[model samples]
Target: MGTINDGNTHPGATLPWGMASALPHTKDFREKANGPAYYNFGDEKIYGFGNVNLSGLGCPVAGAVPLKLSTGKFDWDIENFASTYKDEEAYAGYYKVTLEKHQLVAEMTATTRSTIYNFTPQNDDKQPINLFLDLGANTSHRKGGSLKVVSPQLITGSQLDGAFCGFQKSTNIYFALEINQPNPQVKIYENQKVTDKREVKGDKAGVVWTLDQLDQGKLEVRVGISFVSEKNALDNLRKEQGDLSFEGIHQKAIAEWNKQLQKVDIETSSNDDEQIFYTALYHSLLLPHVISDVNGEYYSREIDKVLVADDYTRYSTYSLWDTYRTLHPLLALLYPKEQRDMVVTMLEMYKEWGWLPKWELFGYDTFVMVGDPAVPVISDTYLKGITDFDTELAIEAMLATAANTKKNPTRPGISQYIEHGYIPIDDRGGDPQKFSWTNGIVWGPVSTTLEYNLADYNIAQLANVLGKNELAKEYYRRSDSYKKLYDPKTTFFRPKLKNGNWMESFNPTDRFFDIRWEGSGGKGFVEGNAWQYNFFVPHAMNDLKSLMGEEVFLSKLNDLFSNGEYDLTNEPDITYPYLFNYVKGHEKKTQQLVREKGDLHFTNTPSGIPGNDDAGTLSAWLVFSQLGFFPDAPGIPTYQLTTPKFEKATIHLDDYVYNGQTIEIIKTGENDRYFNQFTIDGKVREEVYQLSHQELVSTNELVFNTVSERLSEVKE
Candidate 1:
């Protein structure tokens, strides 16, 4: 659907999702979609408690209890006015504020190994009231955990019984404390697993839970968490705050964050960019939430794991190879029923772990980072139909984990990266696999095996659109082994050798940060590099512009989007500045290089994010370039348009869907890139118009003109 009859001749920027505008903090029902402790599920408020011991397992002693955040200044700048704190509170655990002149309380419990925080001061009465701990805040290594001050009158009640907190892998975590006092017993000792340059003496110890004896009124505390024993920390305090109190377990954790922020219903008028886009979509739905409870159960405690005892939903520390590109494709477009319960939690972690997770946390998969990137974010969210699972057992567990990570030759550097295209530099792929952090990332040093052959050619085009045509022609012949490590005399996409020759001092501007090895170890690789991943083989950008032509691939795609040294901060340079909308007339230079890279590379604060946002995969490329259309080529379903950040947008997919969309961005301001003119849904139409994905989930009407002078006239 395209159109235009205004003459200036640029009918290239397509975007129509009209009459939809709501998300301005869904109209202050406690305003939050951003700012104020980051993810404010519209403040129905439930600070934190991932698995405060419901026994379904999951607890490094998580807790963030701040519900209303004092209402305004974007909720006291989420602590910074109180002065600084968003380093994602240790994977979002520990945080408590009850001040009015200090009634403060903090508790982070664990101890299957380490991590313990217990700060209590009811009235400051007898005076010893200073308890503020950040301890390497948001972590860069405080290693384990500890803080003490116990003695509710020389400690009684069985010396504070079976204490608790949680977390074990990625260098353990634990915590414990007990007090029912008035106020006045102080001790502050934090041990990040010691070793302050070898002088180990008991490295550092704690558990002295004292606030003197403040009992000025109702000062009770007894938190718990455990892997097993300390009687599972009084059975996770009788399955979560038994006999509630602590404001009824912090109002049942703000009614479980208002039932996961009432699923989604935003409106928007700019209440501070809808509180930073709904608190970054509420910190992107609290880490693959529900790590298991409601009896599906959980508990893994890492190290050559086993024992994941589940019920149904068990998503642990899933960095899902960087939040399955664009935080699970915006949770399959605004939670399509939790994207069909996260593809039934990835076919229940490939039926209790046999191979699926490429970076799991907690219940251990920690194969940590790098492609196998959960197969192009679970096969482009089950081929955009967001399946309700068992889609032929999720395509035979992604064709048995991409044919066992491509025929496992003791996978680790994965069978010389599917029989050599690039991995070897000796020691079977040299020094810590060229340091994807000492053997973690096997490929992805600019052209991460072309993002693993374009996510194995979109998981073999979603196994031939679900029919599985012989496992989609054997993964489209292992996705055209990237034309056997293409070199065509250094056109780029290096690393090959084994007599093929290319590796030695190959410096494509040493984009690999430190010795060209890929993905983030090459800091700017997995996120960006080699001039934004050699214009990301966009399924071979026109066979790489016929070996560099069309005026040297449009001046190397306009200096890779106006070279201020491009790093739109991750996701292989997110469609590298909309690769001038697939070349042809250059669609008004892809709508003026996406509004000049969202106005000289974005800005809204907290370092207005730029790199390592691999969580919402760079905010799903700003929700598909603010909805103009751009899915360059993820197993080719269809999408390609430019310019859209809302002038009108309506997308209400529940209750028998309704799309009433609209986007009126025709700002040609004429600088010239591409787009001539035409019309559709009204018929004036022209060429180059790929839209599919069921005409973008059933469309309605779309319009655009924006040519600001440049029409020598050429209509067929």
Candidate 2:
């Protein structure tokens, strides 16, 4: 799931939310570590490792500094340094692999900020280990950097990388590399040009070293990275790994992962579902990663300055447009305190960046995807009872983005959306500053309008909770703007021209909206067709049903699945299966669709994930589905009930918030697919559609009386 579909998750040693990863780079037939993913099943030749990478994201994640090692001599040909290998093993915070050509065994362990590597070279000649520190080699575009050898055993440098999803946002990575061996000789390389100078700086710069001495017949290296500065990188390495042995650090990392995984435990009959479930859980927690240094300092790309976090730990890499759906809600459920800090991070981003994050990467607003997504994420968190931050400031930020018209970064066409009820397809105000919106640059006016409607819907949710009824009413009315885009002729939400005319000959399946005359054949739906985005109104489900009529809505939903319209790859319709619960007496369809999609798309292989993880966007969908509840409508803080894959699933809620309570879901009955009903702590539920956060944590158990194949008919 992490390796395929541009998930780009490297097989390496990295702590939970760790800034640095020790990734094993390979020289493959297509492309090796120089590509998005560091380790794939088909990759050949192991060329040592790189120090940092983005995990499970959909963009091209550049390698910070790749360290390639060989056992014999100094060579300018980096191609000759790699060796073919076997025997690979990976665990949390640890990875082990062997180089078959050189008979070398390499292992790595990671801290939150650094990755510690151990290499054992079984060279019959007992030659010194030769290593290359490539500052220039990157998986993505490398914008020239500088490197210096501070000492015989130490090297420090920085690499400038940017344009996540082709958005013009760059991050400067600084690293301090240390060799555990004593009496090491060094040289420099600038674009493969060798020099005796201890320092080098260029587009292709690196430091080569030969280590003659080793401890216990092993060569160990440590590299720490920071976005702030080289000094902070060195201090991060020293502060975390100081006075600790390799085993001690590895054990500490393992313990931390154990504690994290222990939050949710499951017992199930199907072994594959269990493996896939835990793997999904693991992938879900790897994003919105820690960006603050050990001393609580971080580089703010929004302001182009270094800022202090003061008290709370800062984090970045918010793929909010994707994560606000379920990843954050899951966090708000399992780890409210951590989720609180994440909310604080988002608020801080608004304060520093002048706008909330669209798809934030290291404090840089990539604005990769459409929508003011921070609205739903913060509102969802607050509605779930984790309100510790400034309520006024949050509301203020929401209002600013909701009202700001000209040069709006998050909401591109606010004034147009307000005047026309929905954004017009020809609105020039929708052009994004630095974003790749699939085929064309005329940002999905229809899709962006839907995103804005959802954002406004969530803003209303927050406003209602804050006791501002008039403000809530205004936003709620604004949220129903999706109704204007709904064309009665096609019965699907299609694009409308600014002149109050429908797009000529509307085709819902066309992915390219009628923008550029060349690509007008395809409907523009922001990486999807109108079919997928048609039923994406999760928040206004009842209103959507009212618009299309009850029977029409149900028939369209059935057509969506039977006619192969429900998309498993995109985010807009990921919650489609659970939509059945929104309509009464059709909850049985939700169960069947959930199980069928789970069986088809998710698996225990490299391509288990149907699409890009998008920083755990798809993985969170799987995690929630497997747990018998899906946050079908994000920002509503209500889980749509379904048949859990596991027989007995235990979700240990946050002790401080839930008062040491745990939500135990015990599913056992004649059928696994259809359940007659479920009971919460011995009380039967009249409604099967939703469960609130408060009611969920306030209970002890939810036992679903289940059935299988649904081979038997469901009893209404």
Q: Write down the worst ten-residue block by lDDT for model 1.
A: 13-22
Q: Residue by residue across 423-468, what tens digits does model 2's lDDT show?
A: 7776635234433443234467788788888999999999999999
Worst lDDT run of 10 residues, candidate 2, spans 27-36
Best by TM-score: 2
Task: Pick the lDDT winner.
Answer: 2
What TM-score does candidate 2 get on C-alpha atoms?
A: 0.95
lDDT of 1 by residue, 229-347 (tens): 23433444446545654545444444544444444334446665444444344445545544443234445543334344343445555666556655676666556565566567656
lDDT of 1 at 687: 49
